[model samples]
Target: MVVVFYFAAFFVATEFALVQTRKSALESALEAGKGNRRKLQTALKMVQNLNEYLSTTQVGVTLAGIILGWIGEGTIEILIVDALRIAPISETGLHAIGAILGVMLLTYLEVVLTEIVPKNLSIDMPMKMMMLVVTPLHYFHILFYPFVWLLNVSAAAIIHLFGLRPASESNDVLTQAEILRLSRNAVTGGMLDKNDLLYMQRAFDFNDKIAKDIMVDRTSLEVVDITDSVKTVINYYLRQGFSRFPVVANNDKDKILGYVYIYDLIRQAQVDDRILVSKLLRTIITVPEVTPIQGLLQQMIQKQTPIVVVLDEYGGTSGIVTDKDIYEELFGVVKDEIDNVSSEYILKNADGSYKISGKTTLYDFERFFRTKNKNFDESESVTIAGYLLENYKVKRDDVITIGQFDLKVVDLNHNYIDWLEVRRHAASPDEQNAPQDKPAEINGQK
Candidate 1:
């Protein structure tokens, strides 16, 4: 029974270790050629031909089961019958009872010892287990090669006859979910930083997000008229701390012709004084709002265009997105010389909540919030202020309860909300009766 169990455990451990070990890591180990690195290199080569290697493990498991059932059950039953010989009146009845007890014990031991324990141990330290088992498993495979080859060919033939391809000889491809799980496990094992893990996960999800999700809305843009003087445009660009300005015609945003960089204006200013802003304008890429962020990023890279005007479904300029915006979406904020030390869009408070910009997307707001709030109305609006205003039907400066927090429109530009004050609910009766907290003074206003 012990020998049979050892064989079963060997197959179980080998199967998991081969599947779980990362090929890249094994390659690195082989390059280093230190410790068990050589063993891992051999192990990785075997698993690369996954179909044939897996067949060997399957054969080992089957043979172990057959041997255990043939000899193990009878051995245990005879022992039980001999031990109970003095107490039992009929030999036949005693033999029957012994057989039942023997079968139950074998099944229990097989599941616990051969299945659960080894598989879990292998998963926890796959590389280490792979190295340890590779040598013995190699010899076993070689001993059974002829038999295994015959079995594999027959299996592959049958599979092909059914109009299906056999499983690939090597399978290193991982699904998104599998990669995410591995990332999460790395985080748990302290092999990766939480923030880095988040960035990696978001990188994989970049395709799912669209330019509209992260682009700057039109109302928040500081565009310039193409008719404006270079001197005037220079001052405005410097004052606003904008790297580039959209050059529009006749003060109509919809008549945007191109864009001018602040650097270009400053450089050309030294060379010409009487130039119009239009003279310095460079062509900008235009993309639809629904374009995938990843596809847009590739287009920007291939064209060497840094800024793109995002158009709405009706073919009007909705907003603009820059390469910087895509970077922020994947890896968080990236500030430049023009960017302020503190973000104008995000303001932290003493009370543990925030005063967030109304133009900020629900995605950015949630990242700041650091907690999932599924109750927020995502259908009516994509921004925090828009969701609050539309869902609660509130006017400017109105306070509303949203999820587990209190939200107040702290600032407004016409009918559109500009800033909001958020705080956790005052749950106690005394706290509720206490003077309500006023919205924090923002942009030098009460």
Candidate 2:
């Protein structure tokens, strides 16, 4: 009975430890060379053939349970009957009572000693438990190879009969959501940095974002006409300090010819000041505004173009997306030598209000405010400026009330709002129960 229960405990521990142990941990250990290489290799093999070894564990556990019940129950019942011989009970009644008590006591011991205890211990230290039991588990698996093989084939055949394919045990890949949750837990446990977690989360979000979500609007773009002289193109590049400028025909943005690199224009100007902008232009790629930035990034790499023109449904230029824009979406904003340290787009005032750039994304706004309003349709507009334009005719000092906040336009550049002052509305009884707004470390602001 004791030996059988010990084997049962071993099987239970091996089952949990193998399932819980990460394959990365095994590889890392093997690479580190801190322990017996042969044993670690065997452990890795067991993990690789997890389904086969799992069948071995199930078979071992079942056999151990059967043997324990066969030998243990009869022995325990005889002991109980002899111990309770002096009790005021008939011989038949005492035997019946002893049988019931023996089954109950055996079940209690088996559950605690062989099942729950070992399972919890293995889960708590999966790698350590796996290392401890791996050698014996490997030999047991080899001995039970025929049984494991038959069991696996039978299971597969039954599954096939039901028109379901056998799941590949090798493909234990974690989903993005699971990775995000694990990253958060790691942060909470002080095992990861918060900024690293944020980057990971943004990477997952990067694929879900479309080009228009991060593009510079056409109105804000600086371009040179295709008819412009080489000197004129150089002057435009010098004034704007941008790496590239789109070349438009007939002073029309919709009639984009291509883009000219600053270096290319400078080189041409040095050779001949009479060269037209169109002659030095590099071919630019155009993508629909709805194209996902993740796919667009691959397109940019394939075409060897760092910038692309975004077109709306009418086939006119709506905005432009650059490699820098996609980089910022994943890794946060990148600052250059010319960027002002004090000129953050989002700034908290002495009062409770916030001074935010009109170009601030609705995502950043919602993240900072710790609130999401269903009324703000992201499909209609991605930026605060665009959202305001969709519902109202904007003018300087115009106050627009959105959910939980009042946006007052502070600065306007042509038809677009450049800056806005955001003030939170007084929380209602229901609103008070929601997450309270706090200072956000976003948009290069602390």
* TM-score (all chains, Cα) for each model: 0.65, 0.67
Instruction: Tell me the deviation in Å of residue 444 in model 2.
Output: 14
Q: List the residue pairs that clash in candidate 2.
A: none
Give each model's whole-structure lDDT.
0.80, 0.84
lDDT of 2 by residue, 1-446 (tens): 78898999999999999899878888999899978888888888888888888899999999999999999999999999999999999999999999999999999999999999999999999988998999899889889999889999999999999999887766778999999898899899898999999988898798889999999888887778988998987765554456677889888989888888878877887789888877788999999999999899999999998889999999999988888888899877786532332346789899979899988877667756767666564458998899899879989998988867899999998899999999998877776676542422222110
Q: Write the per-residue lDDT of candidate 1 for residues 284-372, one digit (tens) a residue.
A: 88999999998999999998878888999998888888878888877777655444324678888887877878888775565454434
Q: List RMSD in Å for every model shown.
A: 13.1, 13.6
Tell me, by lDDT, which candidate is best.
Answer: 2
Candidate 1 achieves a global lDDT of 0.80
Q: List the residue pairs that clash in candidate 1.
A: none
- lDDT for 106 in candidate 1 is 81
- Model 1 stretches with alpha carbons more than 4 Å out: 32-34, 160-163, 169-172, 208-214, 234-239, 263-306, 310-318, 334-446
lDDT value for model 2: 0.84
